[model samples]
Target: MRQAPVSLPLGIVVRRTPSVSRWAPWAYKAVSVIPGAGAADWQVLREDGDVIEYHAATVPLELWHTDTEAYLAGLSARVPSIGVVMRDDDESAHPYEILLATASPYECQDYADSGEELLELVPMPEGLVALIRDFVEEHHEEEVFVKRRRDKKRIDEVEDGRGDPRITQLTDVYRAPRAGRPN
Candidate 1:
């Protein structure tokens, strides 16, 4: 029988950067909001037992048997960061319309990053990491990497099948006009 998949809890950290308005006077706002200097909001959109029991915002992490290994690889990074898809609407009129969070580095690479979208490398909450580790231990099967060897074939000196130039040797060079009549 197959074991039922479980939804895990993942903690998200959002970092907000401060900046001065485009038309700010030179003096009043001399000290603009420093980039990477701001408050952090912790939200886990899920509520499991004691694991998700933390009274904070969280998202339910659903892991399938197939995706468990990949997800585990992402979480295994030295500095694991949840990719958040957030919209940056300062220049435009769109508000809160952006990609929130992604789970993998590969996905983050392809994630469209605009000046508006904020991407942060927030550490994964210990509780959430522990929760994911438990699920991975139970469902994730480590795939051993094996290098494949190319097949070796015997090389013939002459009269080879496809590589044989003798087979395609021109028999009647004169009779076979370059661009005259059909052969």
Candidate 2:
């Protein structure tokens, strides 16, 4: 499939874990992955006053292109904003993080659906739609829905008694309440 050329305004956060040594003591190794200690490394690709708060150091966040259409469609229709998962690089016990932004509905939903990741919906920021408009128009194809027509010859009601064209009296709905009995 040919993908459209679109630029998304987003960044990722990563935590630099201390290098492990095969000869290191068990206690030292255990403390290295303590989950909270390494979380201080959370930083966006571009530092723009964004920071991860109380996020784990191991989980890696990413954005994929396949979900672009769903993101565009969803953002355009229902979802008001997007979400992100990372760590709050500051000193804190919690090593994992979930943040909300008004930019990436598709990526937000993708992470949210992972069963483990959490999402916090917020109001989409101004101009986010304009950024997505060009991309959506280039990639989204509105599905044409065709309604199936009902056959006019088919009986419309249960009382019509299809395949049995003979009409009976209302009192004799089922061949006179009793079989072999005259109404």
Candidate 3:
């Protein structure tokens, strides 16, 4: 029997600092994730010097049985991280809109490849690490590697339609017709 998918509420915290470049005034990045946090979106959490951190959004960190391989790969990393995806929203007060938080690196790579959203890798909390580890332990099944054997038939033995039928040549059937030669 397959186990039900596990979901935990994760509050994503984003930190903003003054940018050195003139084009952009502020630089934003996801700093941390609060496990089981139930805070309102865009709520100011703390400020230190010129840096400001906000609880950008609370999203579910879901772990499905089908995605155990991805979760396992993430958990085995040197620094286990959770992916925070923020979309660009020009209409909103904040430049970025907080999207979902994911534990799978493959999913994060897909979003990053699109070049439409900002991706941040935040360190996963100890609790979340244990939770995801347990989920993987319960659902993950090792797949046996199968080597594909090549077919026995020799493709070079047959000369069926090897070259253009319009040009007939005994030695080099695939040679291009010379300018003076007739096709």
Candidate 4:
């Protein structure tokens, strides 16, 4: 198929200690075998103030010239998902060399205001998405926040660490059994 010049906003940059073997480059080549793979490109960019090395590439939506979905499925069989990292060139020092794995894919528009940022786009298999979603769901939560008491009371000592023991007492102080109920 004819290659089309498509440009995607540079998002996140990721650094990894690539395997020190011939397989490293070979692995990249293998992924490139998928259709539309050539369209996806990458470039090494400057690191952030933290000195984290960064690389930017386009997410590949094809495999072996096959549809994105098919390629993703095949990748899922081998890898959990792909990872990428991002950093701003204007904000970093020269010759930075620390690689950090990004927890998620970043959106280029999200940081457009930064002006001429460097992005390392990477293709992650769909399976990685599932893993991330599951992890977030299991870890992130929304609820009321309360400070813990430093002093340990008798009831507090008896109760498990899940809930505050003073909750019942606080509720009663506000309003109790309609205030006119029998003993």
Candidate 5:
């Protein structure tokens, strides 16, 4: 049986703080995600001293039936988190562009492996957690472990193909070509 995919609109909360170093002016990171949030793009939420928080962007947080196993892994974690994926954007006002929000830790690892993307693990909201838990419960099935048995055929019975087929002599068939030897 196939199940339809689920999705929710999530708003990414990004915080930018003044950097202490002279090389960079600001440091940006995704702090949290708001579930069922409307469209937003770098809208300022708060400002204090040199720190500023913005509702960076709203993106679809999708949940697939096939990825329920990954979601299960995230739910069981010590601190269940939502992976916020962002990418660098030079032309945009913000340093990074919010790409997506995901509940799967496995998918988060994939984004992290890319190294080009900025990935953050924000604590999952209680409501979001409950929603994912319900989805996982419905779609996730405990996969059975099946050990694979080796083939019964004996490979030693066949003649190895490593020997040169052109050499008619059985003894010299396996002889490797020497330097300056024409054959």
Candidate 6:
């Protein structure tokens, strides 16, 4: 059976409640400095619990854009040492929004300004990948979906059951495992 492409790496969304002493927007700026911070949408919630949690949502990297990076950078620059719970206007436009915090706001801002929507270039450590994969596997169910086809035409035009022999030979050569033989 064919498998779906491995799911894209997860982008974490973090949220924090504003402290009573500080303004909500400023709170977000404050939080952007602690290491492992990323862009997030903020909301004032009345729920009971800790002020923040990690891995609140595992979203496709494509959903996050350079604007998130800029916002994070601006937040980090504004408050170099603390994590603040700031209100994010960008989330309002999306169907679902998650609040997140990041350590480097400048990097976030740079990414946003570049018009890039994906964030996977930043390699994730193995532990974090495991954490995210576990979260997704536990909370989400996989569905089999139709695969999209590429635009390129097939090299073989003949209707014969056999394919081009050259293709199989090339594939065999390319896919052969590295040297270390049992034979």
Q: Among these predicted structures, which one has the highest lDDT?
A: 5
Residue 83 accuracy (lDDT) in model 3: 95
The 10-residue segment of model 6 with minimum total lDDT is: 26-35
Give the C-alpha lDDT of model 4: 0.36
Write the residue-wise lDDT of candidate 3 on 23-123 in tens digits: 99899989999999996678999999999999988998988988989998899899999999999898989778888899999999999999988899999
Task: Give the TM-scores of the predictions, in the order they appear.
Answer: 0.47, 0.37, 0.84, 0.24, 0.86, 0.25
Candidate 5's TM-score reads: 0.86
Q: Residue by residue across 119-138, what tens digits does model 5's lDDT show?
A: 99999999999999999888
Stretches of model 1 off by over 4 angstroms after superposition = 1-5, 8-17, 20-60, 87-94, 98-100, 112-118, 146-149, 154-183
lDDT of each residue in 4-74, candidate 6, tens digit only: 32224343434445556743422222211212434333333234464553333333332123233332333
Lowest lDDT block of 10, candidate 3: 157-166
**Comparing 3 and 5 on lDDT, the stronger one:** 5
lDDT of 2 by residue, 51-125 (tens): 222222333222234555666755666644545453332456434443423245656566667766444443444
| TM-score attained by model 3 | 0.84
Which residue ranges in model 6 land beyond 4 Å of their true spot? 1-13, 25-50, 62-87, 90-109, 112-123, 127-183
Report the number of the highest-TM-score candidate. 5
Candidate 6 TM-score versus the reference: 0.25
User: How far out, in Å, is residue 153 in model 5?
Assistant: 3.1
Cα deviation in Å at residue 113, candidate 3? Answer: 1.6
Worst 10 residues of 2 by lDDT: 27-36
Computed on alpha carbons, the lDDT of every model, listed in order, comes to: 0.47, 0.42, 0.89, 0.36, 0.90, 0.37
lDDT of 2 at 16: 31
Per-residue lDDT, model 6, residue 93, is: 49
TM-score for predicted model 1 compared with the true structure: 0.47
